[model samples]
Target: MSVRIDITGLTAERIHFAPSPLAEMGAALHALAEPAHHPGVQGWTTSVSACLDPCLADRMCEADFLWRTTFSDVFTPSAGLPGLHTLPGATLGEELDLLDKLSDEQFVDAALEFTCQSEYARRDVARLDDPRARERALELAAARGSHQVRFTQRLLEDPPAIRAWFRELMQDCDEAFFSDVWGRVRHQLVADARLKTDLLRRKGVADALSAVSGSVSLDDSGRSVVVDKISVGHTETGSGSLVLIPTSLGRPHLWVLHRKDWQPLITYPISSPGLTAPTSVEQLTLRMSALAHPVRMRLCRHLARGSYTTGELADAHGMTAPEISRHLSVLKKAGLITTRRHGRYAQHQLDLSVVSRLGGDFIEGVLR
Candidate 1:
């Protein structure tokens, strides 16, 4: 119910096999599936671009593109992953050309193929309630050394209560986020384009959006499934193209639905095995948190040099005794710095050993 999916025994390639002649389009699906090919997966979408603040989508696009590009560069394909080399159709170049020149009809075919496969593929990504699935998928995608696996395995073993402490924004996000109605709103827009429908009269999207025109079919369980027949309009005129934009919304896509019928001209698949870098998430969450403030980071820096007592630290930081105490209290809560009372003035220190590990991870995140 919480968007959790098992993904226990899943492999990334299984997604392309079903719902399409992926073996024939095998070249196509595999080309599309990888992180390298489209580093823009989470940033391109047609839905919210139509409604949300225009600048909002663009700004979001810049930010997500930055992260995804950075993340994609480091995502080494799993060595044993099935589709790494089983490319069929045209070379990736050909497929990319096809992607750019893809018609409304073609887009429908691919999307239906993708969705059908995703129906099964999602079973793996979504069914996972365990965050370890995320951790493992990340390890599988970003496998570097045994230490990563061992470390992640150990962290995964920790209970969820502690895990949940790490939040995305360090603050609460409301429903306007891509999770609730807006998510569906964008989804409907893309689905409309993908399904290429004007009315849910045929499909079940209700009186939602409409589609362009053209027809597309994919091999569904060895059978051809007519995904759509719709015509689509391009937002970027004279260019004959659709642009995909990914969003921060937890939902998996940002897309461009052909206005003619509603076929998705462009879709950015934001969800993936390594998409949830648990360690990075943890580090980012902790670091981004304004626990003690800039002054606190300075304090932490000083403490890392060596520990000091409350009075000495307060005088050094040029803060009053109570003010410094408050800062130390916040740092303690953040698990960054700790203090122990000695005589009248409590000794405050960087909590070196623990902070060192945190610093190591912080460096790792930056490296990643």
Candidate 2:
């Protein structure tokens, strides 16, 4: 549930915050595919999805590579824009140039490795040797109708065709969606990068990282940083500098990339006031609806004390677990509470800041 980054002997200079235009574009495509996960970009998601070719959009949505692992080196910090300060100033032409220069081998290798990194692929071919496992991985990938399956297979069979398809996909996204979306979000990305840079300058690393998100924190050992993610946890030990990228496109979650060769990169949501502000009128209606019930209010009050499992709350209230789970879901979607899994059960806790903000916003609106 968390990725622990071991930076035991690293200095402050080792941590760098860089924004990427292409990376944001990749994130935007991700949001487009999974719009429900990114409430902040719902409007853009709809707009961009409408712009994309139906077949292409479907393929993008079906791409397990994009959704599953950050193991894809093609989206790494060094892959797109060159320098740390280059992203804010990068143009679409630059992204295209970088994409054009990407070797066919890098794309094929990343795609295949992505398949191998998946839980299903790992499980399917666990006992098999390398060659057989890779073949089985491809079979499983193709059976799932994965977006990159055809491209990956073609790379081994007809390399030129795979390269052409990859280029075409990149060009299609860049021309149809990325260019305009990047233009719209570029200033915000730049502002976020500058803000983080200023924080690093004034407050040092720990305070700066803490400011980004509550889920990001320095570990108890003070020798590493822990990122609260919902994926398989791993410990990476190396002497590489850490790159912290603030992305406007990837919200509500942190994307960590830790490969053998590349610098450890953590792309987290940008802490912009407006970006993290309370929900819109429609969203407020949903939150208000979720809070209107007596049982849910009591649940919130109970969680205010500390985190509680659904079973515990159900037992305390003499209600069924299913009923409690439904209530918890409502509260969670309303941003009133957060749930983290521990073993087999999920612990739900009230988000005090969100509750306070909701109250303040309600009071101000009523007064107005």
Index of the highest-TM-score prediction:
2
Model 2, residue 289: distance off in Å is: 24
Per residue, candidate 2 scores C-alpha lDDT tens digits across 1-368 of 55677878777766777777666766776676667666767987887667678887765655536544332445553532333222322664455455555454444444565654454112233212356655765776685575556655555565456555655676677777787777777788778767877888898778877877766778777787877554444444355567777778776657676544445677777765664542444455567899899999999889999999988999999999999999999998888898899999889999988887786555322311
| Candidate 1: stretches off by over 4 Å | 1-283, 341-345, 352-368
TM-score of every prediction relative to native: 0.28, 0.65
How many angstroms is residue 142 displaced in model 2 relative to the true structure, after the best TM-score fit?
A: 3.0
lDDT of each: 0.34, 0.65
| Candidate 1 lDDT score at position 284 | 40
lDDT of 1 by residue, 169-240 (tens): 111111223334333344533443333322333442212111221112222332212222111222211212
